[model samples]
Target: MQDKTPLTPRFSYKSDRLKPLRAFCQTVRLGSVSRAAEALFVSQPAITLQLQALEREMGVGLFERSGRRLTPTREGQLLYELAQPLVEGLDGLESVFKDKVAGLDAGELNIAANSSTILYLLPRIVEHFRAEHPDVRLTLHNAITADGTDLLRADAVDLAVGSMMDVPADLSYAPIYRFEPLLITPPDHPLATKTKLELADISRYGLILPPKRQITYRLVDLVFQQHRVPYTVALEVGGWEVIKQYVAMGMGVSIVSSICLTDADRGRLATRSLKEWFPSRSYGVIVRKGKYLSPQARAFVELIQPDLFTRRDYDDSGHSER
Candidate 1:
């Protein structure tokens, strides 16, 4: 038979307690016991007591006081660094677990979209849904063609918005818009002075374009390839906003979605249709094969779709059509 002895305290204080560790970390981060107390919604004396308890447990002074200012000592710095991550991680874990147990607050939603969709479509949708389902949190990730598709395949995102290119066999999409790309030139540029130009005529000047990874870039490439159009690309930007800025600077001419150009932008740049370019791009939503959607995600999709696909203005005869 083995004899059992009662466990004795190895340190001067209880090692299992988290309150002192948390208070010490908060004090160090905020730079004062009183400030930490205010932030934590505790009294100043309570903060002091926790810190003292922590220092006693460790058998070392954690902080040195200079008048009203409290600075961490060498040992305090080590302990502060060690305690901070654990305290924060535990707090986050607690919140997540508690929310899980409550059943009402469930999980998060992840959304991915291309640049144009994020800037043009998502804002109004997010705002409309957030009014009611404020408890659900959402993350939005934006990328170009293959990256966006990869995000969907990897299940990194619950929803995606992009040009309705070749969708994966398992996935589904709803076409939102069929939009023509407009040739853009800054108001001050010489090209802006021209009336009704063809793609061949515009190819003479330097062009600012999106990178080949983008769906718009792929469409542009297809157009040039089909017509055997030879052109000089002065810049290849990764983002649509950057392309717009470069065009606005009169650096080069660009082709972009006409809808992205607001009434305010009309004063800065000029847009004209290239009648020869017959191809139009389709933008739409992409969802996973068998994935279940949260209520917030479903609501967001509905709100944005109406704006993109279903807007109707009647004629004098009370008729509407594309």
Candidate 2:
């Protein structure tokens, strides 16, 4: 009646609806109910039941099995797109609250980067972060592109700092530094003093390069193939430092990024710009597509470059975070 009785609530007050939403979102996120259960510290059957309740409440089929993996239905994907941010925000609430009250005093951050980045790019940034927030714990994992991407997808690392050539849809990268490609040779090498150089000129000498699996080798291979230039590898080893050392000893010449060059190498290695032949590599920060960055993580990332991930566009440059 228009009198004292109130209408029934649209939302069920007897049970918390968040549990079901969390179960559904996690199942969709992980593509496996068991994995979702493990991630959420719940039983498999409980996750299954919550998912069932959520599907029934929404009156739609949410998942269909594709071989061993659970694939979300069209409606389910729409629901997931709408609900996942809510779940992540809710989950990160405590971290956000702590950040507001305590700042970066006692949080932790994990980052993944390759050896070169760790050696050259991160030292200053890391030192500054440590100086500003002494109580915050920071860990850096040495990882290449593939390993770093896997770590981000698994939520094992808060972010990664590296260079990427092809950005996948599920990751975000923000490039902060641009370095040119350079040809490095021992000061006494024949090509070091050549006035006019060409690809053929460089191909005349054996090259000290990273392994075939690394992008540098692949890029060198592609460039040579495109120009129909034949070349030999004097050594196929990893690590730019090692490559530089061997190049200095006249083991072989190398094409390397300028980031690795320093005043220390000027006496031993002759440098020539190869930017015309090779694309400039860009290095930056990487984060998962839908990840909610903790305040500690955010502070560290912004410390490097304030403009990254401003509008939450992951892989904004459509390039990988290598």
Candidate of highest TM-score: 2
- For model 1, state the Cα shift of residue 112 in Å: 0.4
Give the poorly placed runs of model 1, Cα more than 4 Å off: 1-106, 306-322
Query: What are the Cα lDDT values of the candidates?
Result: 0.70, 0.83
Screening candidate 2 with a backbone cut-off below 3 angstroms (N, C-alpha, C), the clashing residue pairs are: 163-322, 164-322, 166-320, 167-319, 167-320, 172-315
What tens digits encode model 1's per-residue C-alpha lDDT throughout 76-98? 98886566556655655665456
Tens-digit lDDT string for candidate 2 (257-312): 98898889989999998887889989988876556777678778767876764544
Q: Tally clashes: model 1.
A: 0
TM-score of each: 0.60, 0.78
The top-ranked prediction according to lDDT is 2
Clashes of each: 0, 6
lDDT of 2 at 66: 92
lDDT of 1: 0.70
